[model samples]
Target: MSAPTSNIADFLRWLETERGLSFAGYPELWRWSTEDLPGFWSAVWGYYGLHHVSDHDEVLADATMPGATWFTGARLNFARQCLAHTTDARPALIAVSETGDPVETSWDRLNEEVAGVAASLREMGVGPGDCVAGYLPNIPQAVVALLATAAVGATWTVCSPDFGTPSVLARLRQARPTVLVAADGYRYAGKEHDRRPHIAEIMDGLPTVRHLVSVDRLYASGAAPDQLPRPDVTRHDWTELADRRARPVFADVPFDHPLWILWSSGTTGVPKGIVHGHGGIVVELLKALGLGVDLRADDRYFFHTSTSWMVWNLMVAGLLHGSTLVLYDGSPTHPDVNGVWRIAERTGATTVGVGAAYLMAAEKDGATPAAERDLTAVRSILQTGSAMPDSTWDWARDRLGPDARLQSICGGTDICSVLAGGSPLLPVRTGRLSGPALGVALASWDAEGRPCVGEQGELVVTAPLPSMPLYFVDDPGRERYTRSYFDVYPGVWRHGDWVTVDADLSVAVAGRSDSTLNRMGVRMGSADLYAVVEGLPRIADSLVIGAELPDGRYYMPLFVVPEEGEPFDDALREEIVGAIRQSLSPRHVPDAVVPVEAVPRTLTGKKLEVPVKRILQGARVSDVSAEGAVTHPDMLAWFARFAARLGSGRS
Candidate 1:
């Protein structure tokens, strides 16, 4: 087999031969990449052979934050780059489900299906600047639809079938897609869920959608929905688009043209639609997946994720390396704790990525994956979404063998790539990430915006990156985009995570500095909870928080103040959980609900979510907030006492 094209060692050697550049180690190389931004990015483009149809006159046209211009005068398409690595030796996509037979799609067949869908989309008047939405699961059809949308120079966005109608509409309404690709139903945890009613409601809400392409996944099992309730919209079957005879054609769009949209909500209730460009993603993925994770052409990569999470998008990028993608569309712990391990072993996955919580849960469940399952093909394990304890890492390393490289990464949906993550040259450390990613000027800053080391501080990036958002949809004058990252540090990207950078360059992420609730790798805004809970007539107000404990466990609790003449009881708790599960998602349902005399709030009437979360995580009241700044100052003591009762175990 041929060697990988973009690993760290290969890049270093190629740098020496092509540019006469030499560095001692990862740190020196990272410094050069950040300091000489233009030279480094230009080298990446050339090293990856990303110049598809045209050449760029300049690498970095502008270096400003929230408006960085890269690779001007270049023309390329992300789908074209992905298709360039196709080979006849291996399958391009391997789809596995809990109760269904595994299906494999070859490179040639994948190309044909993508071309057919692209042709159909063009015939529907979909072109550049148009949006195509997907309401599907993590299946091969979803992958083909996204690639086809890119092939036609259209922006793609998707939400998993598990999401409720309200949550799905909250995002799709903003994009205003002209075409929607949906699945009639999906199977999860050995059960079939018919989503036709939900899709019909979503379609009713999205008036801009003129076309609906349905993938009948449940038809084989005789559980498909009989008919969709919508008759005004044009309908097409999945087979029609996939079987149409057509040749592959790619649009030569500009470098910064919008490729896809990913949603990341903040303190505000609305979800922000972050748009990434074609050129930025092509180069960034090659660096992040190839160098950071050390992915090779012959390797099989598997990451268990829903279509809603950004990791699903990253997993799709594995095709750029000609690597086989192993996709699972079901619950991770359906039959047993060893489900993920069994899939990895069966698929011969070289790189396995999952949230840290899943491994911790497996360990707690007394699962011996390495002894029971043949995971010898797994060369690396990538973890993200939360901090992993030292004991969890020790347990995983011992069970998986010393040869396995365990990496705890820290990045977000905003960029759809790694900021501080794995490197081939760095050593694995317990409770810490390997280091900052190359081309990312990452640092920990104190309250005064000064760089700090050996102590926890705000995570900030001092330089611009290629994969940053091109713009947020509907964000006129870049107002929302600027206010999201630049308002905190002015010209620097504040990632909202508290981190520590040791002298050796290894980094540790504590948790989110802001009020976002991240439960099992799925991040939801606190405002999303408020929108559901506060709407109830029996609830006067509510505050919800997701806290990561030191023992690798997450505790999410909802505190509510009952309305006048209303009492909080078992019935109310059930109501709250049902509302959250049915409206937002089953993932965001709080672990516990408690009745409170009053909800804590700041003087500005904003809910004190971050302070309450910090208190629950064992911080002092004074350390978290000032008494003068809060409406109910004594509520801090109440939360502190509550933390004391739970103790370190967070029971």
Candidate 2:
């Protein structure tokens, strides 16, 4: 994988001449990341066609988290921009369920529905700064209600319907939402799961909620009743709330006004409430769509994500780009294993984004979409949330048509857009993220805070980007936000990704900074362990964690999921350990090899290592049980038993 000699300037020129993009599209974007960032970002707000009431003369009033005022004088409604180019007939949302009939909402109809919902909220005493909590699926109702909340100047927070009652209560308690929107039930894997009971439990726990609005999709007859009550709960049907009202106008607010409160998946501790601002989020989303993904108005954008993942927020940006958003609310491989590819073929999705885990699953299942379906409409496939293996790229090219671009995108919820990804103008590399986003100053720095190439180091952004989180909710003086990113490197945002920039300037991801195991004072990323062990035909997936023995020595424990029906024998374990020892170092060899059925993962499909470490330590693990454990829960039990055996010197 060779790095293009073309810098941001050359890339922009190629975009203009070869890609046929306008030269004036995003000059500030190219200049700010390399030159004056503040000016570049200030220009981005106007270049992206954002709607603001007043022209902001100042780019940033302060640099501190709590004191930062972006577009201080500017006043605009976030919902207005989302609804700006919408038409009456254009499909705003196309929602398909797992087992039931599909539903569609036109742009004008969606706008009207949002207005009615907003009117209902206003009538229910909901006001600005009030939180509107949603415990629903990725249905059209959720989208409409979220937009309505933004239109009414209320902050919105949502969790997927799959979340357990305790997780929902924890998030709603933190946000203290006044209005709670839920569904009667949802379908997953051809089974209808009743959410009414979960909703009741959540309402009982949250005394702050004043209105409980329920979408009637779960009713046996699909009838929209006025209200349903059980004990202290009274639910208002979503359809009944939709009454023709005068086109509800949007409320103008400052650019830094809070739009939504998103939570960090609580795999270790309580979920942190990260608040995002209007101007920064809007500009960042537009840049990601127009510049990063090169989304066009006529293209149909599809992503396999729930409301829980950050990709959902990024995918919603396509609506702002005037592209039809094709949303599927079910298992990626449900009804049949080919559900996602079938959806792509049916929708003619030009740009499709999916988590890397799904690609691995496709490889395992021997799924080939290009041979079975017409994928010519697909332009690029954006993959993130986990490191994509080289094999996944080969499978994509071989199975998903040669013309399609395979973009290895890497970013987090903290930034809202990818820091490193592929550009359409560049040639596709095997496993590396083609390059950094135009305005992102992404580089690898060593432990001594010196920039280094061809070696693994911390991934840091030297300059500020608009989409960075403004502040955490209720964090007095922004202490936590500062400590999270800026505490490690003064004045620099250290994204906790261990990466190596090769001599060719191609970046290869190691793993999370926190999860990097230190054995005998040598830092080893877990991805290195997986790359070595999982490459063997006997292994399916594995989780490597550094465990402290009772003797106070830290040792690496490897839990592997073997290929089905393959016996996990001592001979195979020796081979796995030998592979790790030879590929990495002798210290990289696992102290104990435990074969497990599955690995625990967060909602975003990231391995939950911290909590697994806690369970190994024999501490009462509560956080693991809080959020709906997506992976097989028995893996924790297997880990506990394995750890006990290792503790007793039985390995």
Candidate 3:
């Protein structure tokens, strides 16, 4: 009906004329990319005009997972690429929160600050291969610290300040960082929280920390604003480093050297520590930002996330493409559900990003963004962290208005990039991802490991991608690394997500594969039930589990948390059941509709379905639940008592 509008059309034309590519359109180019792996990635590095100190001897040396090496003999510094293209005083970073006005820093200023921070880190005796950890909010200081660590060729790890002492110690201790960076405190939801006590507990648990650098946010100037109990470790103030204005030193390292560490949510046990490299991240983000999101060099990029989320790390990579970043630290709903929308309008963000849950909440609040805010410059809105309901897509259309495309991306900490997401040349279908990311080798495999199209199965990457974790921290002998991905399908990387790919290449992701509900030999995702139940006005949240008994019988119970003082009657239950049966299938309906106080969820908003299912199927709660992993660990007690009573009753 209309011509296709793409931000990357000019780039594609350049590839055709300059690179001598014969591909005509997006489909042909996509096929060429997935088929000729080396050519596709090499074209990306070249097209992005990335600077390197030395040329790569080979594009891909070995094509093996956990063993694949990319850009052999290439020597480059990540921070250098991030700062290479920008030369003017234009804003490179805009930091905002719920409390104050947005702070803008120019590209030149960011370069100088990063150089000074890197110099400060060197003065602390940090060198190549050393580890630096950030226990801070999603502020500019966190980004500066990460870039400084990368500039020094040291590994960086981060956790949000919102985490409790146990959560902080459980993750940072495994990295064994010799240096730690944190803020004195942060403001959230009309309250101020001091991190001094939490840092004391964390430092006591981590004996390996030699240097502790504190960012003075809550207290701007003072020698004793926040004192640490661990007097043995050297402490440096963030303001002091800026005052010195020392020059930064860049390190030239191998392609596969560790750049940062991202942890699993650790709900079941100690979070799985994943280590990613510089070259892999640089190349991967170049493709993801350039082609997948079609992000421009001058565009303002914003993603609402804490430092704890993997998306925060990805947002920092916006610098790699010279995209100005708009960093927000406070709660997304601090003043109201419209906080993020205001930031997008104020920043003139070409692309805005947020978790799927945030959009759902705003839509539920009856937010009309275009009417309430100035969104003239907004072109696209990216949502990830989970599959979005169809209602989210409809709401974004009405709220953001025309020219703002809703991109529902699906990827996680495992790959550090998207598996299925936005495509400029493709149509954005409601409740469906645009398509597979270029060069992802993405496919859906059935139970017997056969690749299937138009059928639901486990999402697996059959080939190696640059951004996959090289290995896990403290996982010597590659035992955990191999078992986490490869053990499921030998060489193929089973990403643990259940997805369906249509014949036209569009993808619809189900929930986690391990948490899929099977009803009388029929398999369905738990997300499907949530898409039906949570849309109701009376229901606040829902959790469903198909527990298998020792006698091979399934107990399909649908648990719902009703709104405050809202009644849950048989009429409402039947309405929910009828909706599921009509939209999905008769087999998809739950056997029982049970009311609960609250459904258990992880701190990151993920339902603890698999772990809760494990607990219901005769496993101990201690083995299935972690203290720091859950949002409401107290809520788990209700589930445990309910599971015990299930022994005497039937759903």
Against the true structure, whose TM-score is highest?
3
Give lDDT tens digits, candidate 1, residues 96-156: 9998667899998999999999999999999998999999999999999999999999999
Model 3 alpha-carbon miss at residue 192, Å:
1.5
The TM-scores, one per candidate, come to 0.81, 0.91, 0.96
Model 3: worst 10 consecutive residues (lDDT sum): 221-230
How close to the true structure is residue 175 of candidate 3, measured as C-alpha lDDT? 91
User: Over the stretch 199-259, how does candidate 2's per-residue lDDT look in tens digits?
Assistant: 7677778888877887766775331232334344446678877754747768676787888
RMSD from true fold, candidate 2: 4.3
By TM-score: ranked, best first: 3, 2, 1
Q: How many residue pairs clash in each candidate?
A: 0, 0, 0
Span of ten consecutive residues with least summed lDDT in model 1: 220-229
Writing each residue's lDDT as its tens digit, candidate 3 over 394-457 gives: 9899888787888989888987888889788889999999889888988999989998899999
Ten contiguous residues minimizing lDDT sum, candidate 2: 221-230
Better model by TM-score, 1 or 3? 3
For each candidate, the alpha-carbon lDDT, in order, equals 0.84, 0.76, 0.84
Candidate 2 stretches with Cα past 4 Å from truth are 1-32, 51-53, 64-67, 100-102, 220-234, 502-505, 548-550, 581-587, 623-630, 648-651
Query: Which rank order by lDDT, best down to worst?
Result: 1, 3, 2
